[model samples]
Target: MKILVADDSRVMRQIVIRTLRQAGFDDHEIVEAPDGAAAKDSVASENPDLVLSDWNMPNMSGIELLHALRASGNTVPFAFVTSECSDEMIAKAEAGGALFLISKPFTAETFRDRLSDILG
Candidate 1:
């Protein structure tokens, strides 16, 4: 499986990648993007199996990326690994067709658990 880890912070991006490997995704292909716009380009070019993005970004927001993908007819699985995990935010993401979301301050166990439900 291919995973796209998109976040503005280099540290956070590394954390997500590390957590994914620690969570048993070692065989999976991993890609990284600094912002939503780069992620969009990646979707078209990289053809990633999944996308994990941050909520807040410079070029475009994660939600905006989701909406753009939906509008452009891309049905690839996408999730947000965001710091701002609110009911309202989740509702909006769900309404926009997100696969799942994991809140920030998460653990490798959390990544494993949430990812199992999605990848299993």
Candidate 2:
């Protein structure tokens, strides 16, 4: 599996990939994007299996990124990892084709479960 992680913070990107690795996703090919525009470009070139993105970012927001993906007719799974996990946000994301909305401070167990539930 390949996962494209889009976040403005390099630390957050590292943490997410590290947790994924610790949770037994070492086989995945991980790609990093510092913002939504970069993420979109990465998606165009990387063709990753899934996307894990931050809600807030420079250049473009995660929601905007999702819209762009859909606008391009891409059905690759997307999930948000952010401090904002309000019902409204989740609903909006779901309506826009996000596979899941995961809250911040997640664990390896949460990653394992979320990945299993969404990708299974």
Candidate 3:
């Protein structure tokens, strides 16, 4: 499976990739995006199986990217890997068709627990 991970911080993206590997997702292809706008473009160009994006990003926010994908009728599984996990954000993510939200400082177990069924 191809997973696109979008985050403004390069370090965070690397950390996420490492954690994904630790979660036993080492076989999958990982595509990285520096911000949501690039992520949106990558969705169209790369056609990833899933998107794991940071909430707050430059150019476009993760939620906006989600909305844009849905508006374009692209139903590729989308989720968030962000630091902000307020009630409002969760509600908005769900309403916008996100599969799940994985907050930052996450563990390998969290990725496994949240992504087993989806990845399978």
Best by lDDT: 3
Local error of candidate 1 at residue 34 (angstroms):
0.3
List where candidate 2 sits over 4 angstroms from the true fold: 117-120
Runs of candidate 1 with Cα error greater than 4 angstroms are none
- Give the per-residue lDDT of model 1 (tens digit) for 24-101: 878888899999999999999999989999999998999999999999999999999999999999999999999778
Judging by TM-score, tell me the better candidate of 2 and 3. Answer: 3
Model 1 accuracy (lDDT, Cα): 0.92
Kindly state the number of residue pairs that clash in model 1.
0
Summing lDDT over every window of 10 consecutive residues in candidate 1, give the lowest-scoring window: 111-120
Q: Taking the tens digit of each residue's C-alpha lDDT, what string does model 3 give over 1-98?
A: 99999999999999999999999989999999999999999999999999999999999999999999999999999999999999999999999999
How do all models score by TM-score?
0.96, 0.96, 0.98
- Pairs that clash in candidate 1: none
By TM-score, the best candidate is 3
lDDT of each: 0.92, 0.93, 0.95
TM-score of 2: 0.96
Q: How accurate is candidate 3 locally (lDDT)?
A: 0.95
Clashing pairs in 3: none
